[model samples]
Target: MSNGVDRTILTKEHASGTVDRDTDLETVLRNAGRLSPRDALRYLTPLISVLEGLHTSGQSHGSLSLDLLRVTKGDDGAPRLRLLKGRPRKPTLQDASPKAALAGRMLLYSSPEQIQGAEACEFDDMYALGHMAYTLLVGEPYWIEEVDRLGFMALCNSIIGGAPEPPSVRAMRRKSIRLPHDFDAWFVLITTRKHPDHFRDITDAGIALTSVLSNPDIRELSRSVQFKFNPNILESPSSAVPAAPENLRFTAVFTIVASISLAIAIVMLLRWTNAQESPKRDPSLQSTDGAPATSNPSSR
Candidate 1:
């Protein structure tokens, strides 16, 4: 080995011309914006399975990111994903060296424990997978804007202390994307600090995430519901789509009208029932104005 370093050459079968050998997942994501639920699951499922297998073997991918993944097109025109091998040894955060601290965007995918000098494990990989899924759904890392403004150290601080914006809220910036209600919960669960709170494994997380993304309610709500944009919160004011005020107003008006009508109907029914049930007064005893006969008139 050169310079007393042990090296090994790895090879695979030559890919056909139809396969896109040059593009990595990061590039594809940058070019394609956010992926649809179908596409995101398609890419993520296999990646999660890979991590699952590694964990099963008592190993872990300390560094996981879109950049580390290779995406190629199959002969059948479907995209295929492969995780590229990295160093055999996982870096420990205890080193606390500037190099480790300055790992750049990779920190975006790191878990809180990983940032705090803990050994990488299945939990860390699951946390990274949650970030990757969010990236694919939201078109960028949750903390990318902060990282761009403040630097990598800021990202580390945020990971250790700050909570990320819910995936559904971030996805709202893209009007076309309608993430399910439970998506945010799923994200939080996997990325939580308590290891026991996380999914049993990456495979389970993937399955649960898939179920959240595939929810029919998202599609139905997308058709009928509109989201109001708050410029103070979302990054892109221009991309913020306003809620349909007319539809909302119509709904409110209809509800009020229906309530009023029901109340009137109930009142009229009560009056009619009372009229029919009231004891009929004798004509001779009844007053001319239809008043009840007053037996005590003479006494008065």
Candidate 2:
């Protein structure tokens, strides 16, 4: 923090992840197999959105090191990541490089341009973002054989001159955790092979390459088993409900039943009324043996 109001770049109240990096990354590394490309996109696209905004505005964050980015629980208890602007790194003399006194973020996340002391441009930030992204998804940075051994000049040379393995391959090489099926190939295809013809336009023209994952080729690889989200983790939508309250609905049913009962009762009442209103049966006119009422008159 600059301790001055004018220089504050980050929003307030975020927790650092240094202590929690291993623990937080543990889940991602272990569940890499079950992780879906969509979820990955969700977790990462926001950071890209921020970077895109900065790059579009002709600004660049020189230090996008893993150590500076923090992950904390948000208001809703969902994990949120925030990046703090870090100072540019300068190589220490160490009786070797041009400038060694100044220090910044870790070199693991630094771009070749940054390593060589080139102007801190937006692409350099992108390179760092990509490295961080690879680490987040696969649990490690891309492999460079002499990463630790080759100090300063040699390290910078290798980083610039040699290509690193695809993130999936490096993750697989670690063999510490189970990986998603076909994830290695799918990762390579999307990140490296996809939309080959137009890749340069986004980079060379200084256009903000918002998201590489938006490529259709990358989406195609998602249909493969490895990138699929587990069905078990998918929360079922709440069951559809009637617009009316249950009590009201039940009352409606009860009213209908009562109406039917009342109708039946009314029909019975009508029948009884008709019977009472009708003339009395001619009991005196007809005999039990079908004889005329002449015998009944004498009896009367």
Candidate 3:
């Protein structure tokens, strides 16, 4: 579908009905009833794993956007969702925001000696999770209304420089959406610490996260999913594949052309040789020319 198309974002027509800024959050919540809190957690858990994986690899979802998220109902009547944001060559909706731009400057220009391995990666995941939490609680995508690219970056740098805010804080500030009382605790539980509360270390963190998904409530809800494939994987089928030697395709074409030409030459040589061969004359038969004088009438 992306055949040379520079598609950065896409939206779907509302299946249930039209939604607007004035639409009551309650109505949206009612429609979203199909997905329960447990279901939402199911989706979020795997997503946490995905984010962790991205962080470990020294990558971030450069193009994180609402379209990258998906929601579906599970067999148990709980609604689950899938979040798939791949690192992209083009700026994602967030990258266009002022927050992303400022964050980039501070990351690139600031003194590097103070930063250590995994710090940037962790911070990147932290902010990304913040955005994710905001979307989850709001039951829709969240974006800053303005597009001051530099200002956004600055905002991100400010957040990263100071204590990270709970999802509740961001929600209240950005969209005036308040979250459950436990919201802060949950946010801290998921994003702040290197390990989730249950896990003592990375290995335990992984196991604990996996165990949470196994919870019946979470399992029922994390069904509907969406994501963009990483562009790096799209480049070629295999990583070990070396770039084709210079002009390899061209060389192949030339080889085929030469073979065809050689075949034509051989065919022409055979035709010419046949043309040069002469038919033998029959001596017993009388010739029409004057040189055949010994010709006699056949004995009757």
Give a tens-digit lDDT track for model 1, residues 1-300.
121111212122223323346476889889998787767776777777677778999998877788777776555665556677643433334443566434655577877787787878888888888889888887888766655655455556666764545567666753446676766667776787463455777877877776777773544323332232222332344434444578788999999999999999999999999888676644776799987766777787
Backbone clash count, each prediction separately:
0, 5, 11
lDDT of each residue in 96-207, candidate 2, tens digit only: 4444212222566666566677777766665665565556655555533345345555555555553444455445655454344433433333233122331232132112
lDDT tens digits by residue: candidate 3, 51-149: 566666766554343344544444555444344443323322245343554345333211111122232334444444444544555664333322233
What TM-score number comes out for model 1?
0.59
**Residue 81 in model 3: lDDT:** 39
Best by TM-score: 1
TM-score between candidate 3 and the true structure: 0.34
Task: Provide the clash count, candidate 3.
Answer: 11
In candidate 3, residue 202 scores what lDDT? 35
Candidate 1 ranges beyond 4 A from true positions: 1-20, 74-78, 87-102, 173-177, 216-300
User: Candidate 2, 106: how far from true, in Å?
Assistant: 1.8
Which pairs of residues clash in candidate 1, taking residues 3 or more apart in a chain or in different chains? none
The superposed Cα distance between candidate 3 and the true structure at residue 182, in angstroms, equals 3.0
Ranking according to TM-score, highest score first: 1, 2, 3
* Root-mean-square deviation of every model: 16.4, 24.5, 23.2
**Model 1 lDDT-worst window of ten:** 1-10
